[model samples]
Target chain A: MDKEFFRETLSYKIITFLKDQIAEKVDLTVYIFKILVKVIKDILNLRVGMKHILNQAARFGVDSLPLALIIVGVSGMIIALQVTSEMVKQGAVDYIGTLISLVIVREIAPIMGSFAIISMVGSSMAAEIATMKVTEQVDAISVSGVDPVTYLITPRVVAGFFIMPSVIVVATFVGLFGGYFPVHNIADIGLSSYLDSVWLGLYEKDIWVELLKAAVFGTLISLVCASIGYKARGGAIDVGVATTNAVVYSFIVIVITDFLISYAFFY
Target chain B: MIKFEHVSKKYDDKVVLNDLSFTVDAGETLAIVGFSGTGKSTALKIISGLVEPDLGSVHLDSRNMSMVFQYSALFDSLNIYENVAFAFHERDDLKNKYTESQIMQIVSEKLRLVGLQNIEDLMPSELSGGMQKRVSFARAIVTNPKIILYDEPTAGLDPVSSTVIEDYIIRLKEELKAASIVVTHQMSTIKRTADRVIMLYEGKIVWQGTPAELLEAKDPYAHQFVYAKREGPMKTTAEAR
Candidate 1:
């Protein structure tokens, strides 16, 4: 081998191979980062888009409200018991009320509420957009004297962000009560501390945190779900794949972001 | 009326359609024909604004248009009635738009027109392939569209379903007096529904004429495509036709 090619003492072949690996790794990082940025940008756009979907979906309010309530109630009951059990074992049973309050109001309720919304509204958004995408319904909307963003995205993102907070607020109360009932019915924890430890010491920041989390979580959920549907290609199978990816990505982002946000808030 | 002026479309540097120009007169049917990848659907999509043309402008005077997808674009979460009603429910700044009752009536009428009135309560899942197509068609027409674009309306359907969809297209032309644009691989659909036919090949409109003219065109690509032959200038997977 020429000195120019071999003088580095690393074989040219191995060096070239390493270079290729780095290039691939860099490309993958960019791709993943692009997706993450898209998710973030769409979430930011949610302030407007989600409102429209919520307004439209709300017209059939008789259907959407009860659906929201049932999901909130069920998730609340299950989460309250499980988390309190863990806290109890740590000799932190008294903190159970406070911890439950934080989890439900600040994190669990918002995330799960967004989950329920995604299951109902997010999936629908994907199916709608995917169907529109393949069938050209979205195209129809675009050509018909209207911008698809205003017609589609604006409404959906709006609905997601707006409705999420409302649903989360309700879900938070339900989740705390979910914990309260178990603490009363099963743990036999008295009502005095439950009320005092949970509701009595409520800080303005806690409320702010809850609302902020709800709003952000809600907006993110819609943005991620609708954008996934918006970018989806191929046929029904592609839609299915997009839906799955949207859910998995949104949940993963939510968990990571929630932890990070919580750390920033408390630490 | 809609016009495509020297339109070209590319995806990731792969030119799917190139340098095509055509016009659809107000309230007229224009059928596009081509072998797959000759960019027939892409042409339709270009005009419909589903896919932007990389190098042309599609101009239309009418602001209200609808597309009937080959697979039907009904929302799965919606029942048949809501799916049909979505056109009316869509928010727009237009004045004197279809009222809710008016929209419902139109939905019922379109459902009746498509022979799917009995299944208004069904979700998209509950409908058969043919029924789904019918529901999709109703949703399109329920908007009272000035232009209706159909992408492979008869694709993957039984002859009976094909004829049903074709008949509805013809009826929409005669009764609703709507302009129709159809892209299809099914020659029978073209023959039955298209008032005028255009063929795309290698991104160009290789042929354009009435149905009779299309049937008699001596162009090798048109002949290969309309006749569903695997021989001639049209490229197949394993060979050129």
Candidate 2:
């Protein structure tokens, strides 16, 4: 293998893979329809005929409870301190609830909640499929009569996709209380005005928009991570490589897509 | 009964099986004896449906089949019971045919049949090579498949393990009344297990007969192969065939 030959071969493989994928591209219109159907089916599977969304609520319960205590707890204290110090001079610290709502609901909740899950779930999925690939378990699945797509990918993607919005909702609630500690008595922000600021941010459009963002972020994380896991190669070392790649890629996609979607929201 | 009809397989233009055809009848063990790279495993893969034939069909006459691969094909994650119950996991038909408890019970019975009782929860990594081979056998028989394909069952085992494997193969045929196709390079294994021997050379069946016929063979390839001689057909084929 001369350097030039190696370079050509590697490029050839990459090009070939891309070409194959392009040729085999599933219908985008059909894929969206399929995903909607899957989401509906998932909802039905969780519990039938419940007015409240079990998928979303269960996701919130599973994802946000502990996250609320730890990551958001610290962030909440820092946010309260930062906002109170800045706004007290202007004597507008009463509006800390409003500002925090804007940042948490619009950005931080969506990013932080989903990003953490991606690190936890994405790597595990990758390690799982990678081991199956290394040991021929996936091949066994195929030979035996089950499609790997339905058995392995569907539940995780569905669970992960819906879970983020729920988690973000929990994060937003946690952050609101987090802002309360330093401000209620220390910063001289009145409780009545703070409640008003929090309640006013609860517009129907804002809630829906936040939800759309959470869903997009969740889907992207699960899709990228599951895709990486399903196609994982090499051995034990490869699992680690895949895990790192999945986390990095999921975070990057979340940030970029979030920015793009946010820009579209206003533009 | 399994039959390979004019089967040819190739990878990157190097022909592995070239117009190879053979038949396996009911209740008989056909041992395919050949050196490595002579396409023995490739042939086994074709029959097992793990690898598709490029130029032919592996006609099963609709007979159900299973395989114990040369290497331990047991799932590392699955315990001994689940590993043996693998055939059930493959098909929706198997799902309908056997309940989970029934599948597990059958797996335990098959494990014991292979002399691996009380170890159904052991992982594949815990087992030695020969034990793994026995578990693979358990997997093949768990379904009561009519045709079982063993790809080099005794390749890396010590003499004791090898003999155990051979006896288990015999017991499986006698007790389960299933046809078996054993592919190996071990002449002793062929003598011990094969009722009929097929010698493959350059991706084709050059010789096939009973072990008695193999002993009486005048064909240089058969003679050289049976005696493990480095002086004849296999040697010449490796050099220039």
What lDDT does the true structure give each of the candidates?
Answer: 0.72, 0.73
lDDT of 1 by residue, A1-267 (tens): 577656666676788989996795466346545554544465576423443555655732323455666666666667667766777778776776776676677767766766666666667666667666765556655644455555655565555556667777776777677667777665668978887778754677888887877777766666666667777778889888778766766776677777887888868
DockQ of each: 0.35, 0.31
The parts of candidate 1 lying over 4 Å away from their true place are: A1-156, A163-189, A198-201, A255-267, B91-96, B114-122, B175-179, B237-241
| Superposition error at A159 for model 2 (Å) | 3.6
Worst 10 residues of 1 chain B by lDDT: B87-96
TM-score of chain A of each: 0.72, 0.74
* Candidate 2 off by > 4 Å: A1-92, A162-199, A209-223, A232-266, B86-90, B96-101, B121-129, B199-207, B210-241
If scored against the real structure, what TM-score would every candidate get? 0.73, 0.73
Judged by whole-model lDDT over C-alpha atoms, candidate 1 comes out at 0.72
TM-score between candidate 1 and the true structure: 0.73
